[model samples]
Target: MILDRQLLLSNAQALTTGTVFSTNTIDLASARDIGIGDNLELFIRVIAPLTGGTSVQFAYVTSANADLSSPSIIVQTPPVPAASLVAGSEWLRVQVPALSDTTSRQRYIGVQYTINGTFTVGTVTAGLTLDREGLAVYPSGLNTAGF
Candidate 1:
């Protein structure tokens, strides 16, 4: 399970002008030994003006083609919800339990906010912090385990 302090995200702003402002990829792949039954916790904070009526979506990918430099790697299906952002304490915590040993795979993480309507300069930024300390990969029986 994640044994580190809570993740921190602030001062997250979009680069371009639009209804939704997003940031580049923040890697979740740490050098820590992550096994099955481990837990993952993410802390995110967003600051921006919402004018459009669009909904915000968050996502992630695990493939090798994940583009952290450019604006790519956004999940499309089963869109995520964009909660109303508040000033000062805009922090949101998402708790995700580790995948079961029988069904665990590598993956990536990313987020996006979309308004229903169209609005210019609706830029916003979301700061994300990830904690995977003391994590271990599971399943693989003894195949994945180095022992």
Candidate 2:
């Protein structure tokens, strides 16, 4: 899959303790539409195994400031086990929040990593995509993609 730099959040970033902001933040100061049947999505994958951490989470946040000094979380992925943080593991494949009021949204759009505990090693890459790959997921994990 081709990743767009503009929409990319983290690019194989090795994260430790604390929060890690995206290399690039989307600026939405003007009115814009994501288009019908489309949603801004995040694709986060692990490039290295994580150790010394209890768990980690991925979140979609919006802020009035470019530095995301104070972020308002729109959505987030479930906290995955630290042991599950292995190379080639996909952390999150989720849709952006369904927003109708642009005026109510913040001026900046970005992502953040909130580590639960101390982490000596962790790496991940994330990006946004408007095009969804295919039919996937079940309401209750019946079977991964089971109907």
Q: Whose TM-score is greatest here?
A: 2
Off by over 4 Å in 1: 1-11, 15-22, 26-40, 60-64, 68-83, 86-92, 100-104, 122-147
Candidate 1 has its poorest 10 consecutive residues by lDDT at: 1-10
Where's the lowest-lDDT run of ten residues in candidate 2? 30-39
Query: What is the Cα root-mean-square deviation between model 2 and the actual structure?
Result: 6.3
Best candidate per lDDT, number?
A: 2
Expressed as tens digits, the lDDT of each residue in 1-147 for candidate 1 is 222222222244542323232344334465544333434454444455433344444433223323432333323334323345333223334554343342233343344443444433334433333453244577664565555
The parts of candidate 2 lying over 4 Å away from their true place are: 30-37, 102-104, 133-147
Query: TM-score of the candidate numbered 2?
Result: 0.76
Give a tens-digit lDDT track for model 2, residues 1-147.
Answer: 556676777777877877777766777765654344666677888888888898888888888888877888877888877888888787568877665676538888887888888889778888888766555666783566644
